[model samples]
Target chain A: MERTAFQIDARDNVATALTELAPGPVRLAGDGEAEQVEAVEPIPRGHKLAVKFIAEGADVVKYGVPIGVATADIMPGSWVHLHVMRSAYDERSAHLNLRTGAPEDTRYE
Target chain B: MSRKEIPSLEELRALRWRGYAREGGGIGVRNCVLVIYTVKCAEFVARGIVEGCQSPDVQLVGFDGCTDSQCAVNLLAGLIRHPNVGAVLAVGLGCEYVQPERLAEIAARAGKPARWLFIQNEGGTLPAVERGTAWARELLDELRNTPRVPMGLSDLTVGAECGGSDFTSGLAGNVAVGRFFDLLVDSGGTAIFEEIVEAVGLDWLLLSRAANDRARAELRHAYDKMIAYCRSVGQFSVSPGNFAGGLSTIEEKSMGAIAKSGSRPIQGVVKISVPPPEPGLWLLDSTPDPNPVQYGITNPNDSEGLMDLISCGAHVVLLVTGRGSVIGSPVAPCLKITGNAETFRRMSGDLDFDASPSLTGELRQDEVARLLAELIAETAAGKPTKAEALGHREFHIPYKYQEKEARRADCERR
Candidate 1:
């Protein structure tokens, strides 16, 4: 199988896109096993693609660690990014809300 | 990833490089003559003096603040007495809080040639530059004769930092550095990593690598302090560049950033500007102490972070950049590594090591690590890094509000 995305660790549900992937079937490989995942959208290089289905509020695993939680239900091959996920540690999400004039949250404090 | 074959411990101990032996039993890879400005007002005159001398060994460094902060003073003193420096020429405007004479005294106490000139007292810029140039030339001549010693890996204190990172940084560049750090620690050498803000979500991961219960608690405290400091400043470690480079959140960045520590048991955590007590993998808690209000956030720029590492007695800093950054430090040499093959190709002249092979699977992590160790040996033996050859000495000291001053400011505001 031609590798289109890279799963950094065996436990990672999100694999990094190795190249600019158009909407198509992408083969992800790691730890001696290969899996076929479809790209639901155009994914740029260095961006993450969901290799496993993640329910809303579930953790997005990468590097064998939980990076953050999904804000929306993310299906396999969907782009895993700020639009569907947010940082678990930083509650403010100030960067995302800057343009929307969203009220600042004190949850981080 | 599995560990690759490494040199035997006995063979590792045999690795040696010629370095300048400092008076205080320290080995320096580069014998630099530093022209330090006490305040920003004197920076121009200091640069003029260094330019007039026209010596690669003579470099410029300084603090930009006019008011005295003990932190600033301590950091400046450390750089002046750094092993890499053989002599120092301190320049001041005379009215600033930092005294040029005092800085020169630090160098003198270290048995290094030291001189001071106040721009105000020397009849302004031209005269100060003339005197400073002559003094720098003399210092350089004297430094040329500094005794060289054969130093082993155990004698080194290496610092690792990542800037302008992308996803490949963790998978390639930082991981390669982590492997190098593992070898360094295994060889009884000291290794340090900083930027606690980037370790926010990965505190537990770092804690798990602590050498003991005490080290674990210390790591936790550092992480807590970093979180509080960031919250106070209403900022996070993630930048627009970071997001564009494929990092979606601080947690993602933290996971990648912590990879530079490798899998070694962290001996302990030390405060900023304090060297590690023993040889092992250590973390430098660069967060400001006492939790001062109105104090700015940490890491104003990559150079400041590198400077902080240097203040902790790092002989050389391994800077991993996936998005590309061209920077260096005056007190410690910088070896820039890049994981992005395109970035390496575009900025090959500025970067030092290409760890892109790890990304392409052409070389295993440990193989790249071995290559990095060889590069470090070459650098310590006087091979100039790209930054050094190109003369990129970017230094900055961020403003830090003292705890007492912050308290007073709060009272006044109320």
Candidate 2:
């Protein structure tokens, strides 16, 4: 597969979108399998696009680390809008699910 | 049994510092003759003087500060004290907040020959230019008589900066620079980075990194102001490129941006003109203006970003970018490093370092860090960076009030 998306770290589950992505038919690099996306959200260029299905409260990864948590259920190729994600540092209301390895208590809490 | 920890300070320093190393005073690459304008009004006069004298070793630079007399005075004094500056010349509008006479006194106390040209006393621009040029010649002659002595690595203050960023910035370039910045700080040299707008989301993380409670509180206050200023601007702290690159919140963007600092203990926090007294990670309190929408260009961005860090007396600036920039400063040498391999290839002519391999996992983090340290030392030794070769002389915009702070802070009280 041609390398298109950026793999920031070997540990990262998502690859950052360096170019504007098209919907409907797409395949993730390295995965080697053709997978479809919901386009439930439109990911812009320079934004992160999920390479695999993420749970409702899973850690949304970027730069090969957990950047934030999902506010709603998400799928591969969905746009991670601001509304659906809360800040890992500044946002107060993000519930850290201990089972999923999120911080149990945030400063705002 | 536990694995051995990372290399000790002495080992790391020996591995990195080459044969040309010294203790006590930090090492610097270039010995610069810093000609600083005490106020914005005196800028043209100072430029004229430097241009007229035109010595190969001399360079002209100034600040956008004038409103706060005290801040301006402190900033100019610090610039004259900067180790890279072998000599100093301060020019001013006679009645400006920072008096050129006071600056001269400070420089003289520091054992550097200081002189000034005042526009009001010297008749006008042309006359002042003539007098200023003559004074500069005398000052350079005095500086020439002053002996050039050997210096050390600890004498260096490297200010890190980034602009025109993309996702690759935080991951590759910023992180690589951060590792080097950590090393620079550990070596007892000062490493400074600014742009309150870019610091928007990572305040709390920074606070946590603070070595003490006082540092943490200062970081909190500065960061809150930064966020409040960003909110006033209406556009989210995260830029369009950040959002497009998949960062959803200011914190997310900040997490990546702040990564350039690497893993270092926050020693303290400071205002724009104040540099860290000793060596440790420090934050420059850079909040956006209250009404960025009204002012259009109130906050820190490319070119102008150099002023904030430089104002604090940075000897050189490390400018990292994913989208390439061509500009550099007249005072401090700018080392331009790019993160994107393709972007670096496309714009290799303008960049100094290529950080793409770090992102691609081809280069170990420490190797890249060592390379950056070597480049920094080389640039300080008068090795021209891409910016210097191209002659990029960017200036800063003066501060202007745009909105009521109370109202601006109310929207995102979070």
Candidate 3:
């Protein structure tokens, strides 16, 4: 299949889904082992997916630096989001919704 | 990690453009005679001159304050001395604290022809408009003869700002701008990045990039002040809507937001209305002035951000938006770039360049960066940006209490 995800760096453990990715052979921008990671679940556009296995408590790198850490062990192609990962520096990450980008705690009058 | 494709100084210095050389040691891509209204009552008169003038280069800007907001005056003064502007026509009711002469004097001091009048002194609208229009037409005509000098990246000062961002913004648009900024700085040009409030949860990241110890101290002070301002205002820069675009955390979002600054060591922090003292990478802090009585909110909108960038003497401003933006500003031309291919296709008429090709791996980030820099060169050499070509010259100067010392940028209050 055509490439639908992008990885910023070779060290990046996650690749951003450029579109709504269904369970299939998802190809990343570059080629290599795990470059053709399978989508373990449906991932929304702009959300992240594990390009390789991410063990619990390990850094999830993007742009060649740690953006967050895996909350649980994540296999190749599994969606990487708030459920399975958390921000290393920002506590507010836990409240964000993946699809809408709206914080769960936001309230309006 | 694989090697990135950044353009070198040799490549940057190779390009050149013809620009209007300013008297005080700078250059202008445009040569417009700006009409400035000092008070709210004079707006119609000032705008009348802009409209009645035959030359399209006659631009209008104003402050609506009846009382003195040093911040407002400073910004107006900065605009008068902007490199894009060649002359000035200052109009007022003569009651506002922003003296019409004071504004016109700025243009004169910058070696540009300037004139001023008061609506009250002129006995009303028609007389002021007729006189002002005649002066503006003549100035714009004579400015057409402003000597054009050869300029390169070293003579340029470009400002970067982003809004309405999405995942593609960080991955493509901002990343490309960052790379472009790096090249601009390496080639002896000045690059100023705003929305410093967006650099949340990354004080270390910001401080680490400071070019010198003085810059480190300035960054610390600006960051602490911004954080304090955020706390007092009870707002962080992030919003619920940011998540809808796929930012996962404040740091995650900030990491993407700040990518436009590139990897150059930050020169130092400067305030609104204050141009960077020298050419380099500078971070503009838009936090409000610490006053006992705060009257207005910060960064009322994105147009204000672009205006602030202009007031600080950016020859052209690159506004990166993943979602997209159509607005522009007076004085300097605004270049809107986006990384969302769909948005680019939909708003191609308004957007200047599309960095979205990088997102699909069709183009490398640095390749897009070079292309964007080339666009800047073209715009500097008299090619109007989409915003300028579309005549989207919107501006805003709210009455905020900032010391004349110049706290720059348009960081939002909420």
Candidate 4:
């Protein structure tokens, strides 16, 4: 059977979509075991998908390392990206004034 | 996965090629003459001379800065005396800080044929171009009689670099090269991997693989310096293109990049332009030795990285690109590899090896490694890479402030 997504490491909480997948049930497997997760949104190829539920301020694990921390509660099979996650090393906000290079105080923080 | 399939060192050493014998103890895979400009001002005439000579074996390279930089002088001197070069033709604009005469003297001291002509002294552009062309042709003729000796894998030092990366880079391209590094190291050859900025998140993992206690400390210090350097500059090595290709953060990109080193215990770390003390897997710390007061936070472009590898005495560089780049170096031959099957098809003319089979699950990692080893052996035996065939001789030298005090402060902070 052709696998739709791959877990890079056994300890990873996220899996990389092998192909573009529409919102639905998807099976992710690697290093022997298989787990099923419902896709909450469209996941593009090479993009990350939450294989395990992650809470706000929790580390997003991939390749057995913390790629970033979640900004909000992320359910299993939800698309993992900039919208719901942010780089652990990068503290600057997205809403920045290009001219002055300063972060703007905004809503939904 | 098993050592049963690995070839014996004796069998591997049987792979030999005819190479130019250096006066000292080294073998040059290419017998070429270099036409180098002392400053950017003389580049046009230098290019004219190389173009007029019309030979792939005659290459042109130079620094752009006019200021006297010890780094630039050392780099130019290294290139002039590279084992691959049989002779040198130094071009100058007369007023630049790096005099062509000094480069010529270095080449001459190494028993290589060297000549210099100043653009200002030769009555400007046209006459200088004509004279330079004539002299370059003479140097080519002189190098034709250079002796060729039998050389093998032990005499080679190979460098690995990754640029324009995508997801397949880690899973396929870099993984395969890592396998090749293992084979090369086991066979008593030198292999180098650089770009400490890309190594940010892999520090502890890398430190665990250091050969000894001192190496572990050096690895730790180098990684700390890299992180400090990046923080001071308010930037990281991740790029927009990397994100577009699916990498989300510097740590994610680093996880992919570090796979190029394979699984060998890192022998030690050496500063930029310094060759490894012994033949094993060594890390070239591309971070400026003493942190400069002002430095470009981002990794320098591919060419500068390639030159750093060459400065460490690499005879060839394995350049892995998932997004695909076509650049090559002047003295060292670059073998371009890509793990994207689509990219390989699109840029077949520019790429040399395709490790995409590893991505498609058609070939195992060890199989890809074996294939790369065969290709590397062929390249060492004088096969021109795609970049060499397409005539891509790109060179660049970056400028950064050199301050000893800043380096001391950086060390103290660590």
Predicted complexes: DockQ each: 0.39, 0.21, 0.44, 0.27
Q: If both were scored by TM-score, which would come out higher, candidate 2 or candidate 4?
A: 4
lDDT of candidate 2 over B25-84, digit per residue (tens)? 433344556677867788888888877986655677765566543433544565566655
Model 2 docking tier (incorrect/acceptable/medium/high): incorrect
The interface RMSD value for candidate 3 stands at: 2.4
Model 1, B1-414: lDDT tens digits are 234454554666688988999986688989999999989999999999999988789999898889877777878887877789899999999899999999989888988999998999999999999999999999999988999999988888999889989988988899999999999998889999988888978877888898998788778777876787787677787776677766777888898999999999998887656778899999987667643355666788888889888988899999999989999888788999988888999998999988977777778788788878877877888888999999998988877632311112232232
Predicted chain B of candidate 1, TM-score versus the true chain B: 0.93
Q: Of 1 and 3, which scores higher on DockQ? A: 3
- Which of candidates 2 and 4 reaches a greater lDDT? 4
Error of 3 at B73 (Å): 1.3
lDDT of 3 by residue, B12-60 (tens): 5787888898886678988899999998899999989999985558888
Kindly provide the TM-score of model 3 when superposed on the true structure, using C-alpha atoms.
0.88
Model 4 reproduces what portion of true contacts? 0.23
Clash pairs, model 1 backbone: none
Candidate 4: TM-score? 0.91
Could you give me the TM-score of model 2 versus the true structure? 0.77
Q: Top model by TM-score, which number? A: 1
Q: Write the per-residue lDDT of candidate 3 for residues A1-109, one digit (tens) a residue.
A: 2648888778788888888899998878743335577898988888888888899999887767777788899998888877888766556657677666566786885
Candidate 1 segments whose C-alpha is farther than 4 A from its true place = A1-3, A92-109, B1-13, B401-414
User: Among the candidates, what TM-score does chain A have in each?
Assistant: 0.78, 0.61, 0.85, 0.75
Supply the global lDDT for candidate 1: 0.83
Model 2 spans > 4 angstroms off? A7-13, A18-45, A54-59, A63-73, A79-109, B1-28, B38-41, B63-69, B93-97, B149-152, B195-204, B232-236, B244-248, B288-298, B400-414
Docking class of 4: acceptable
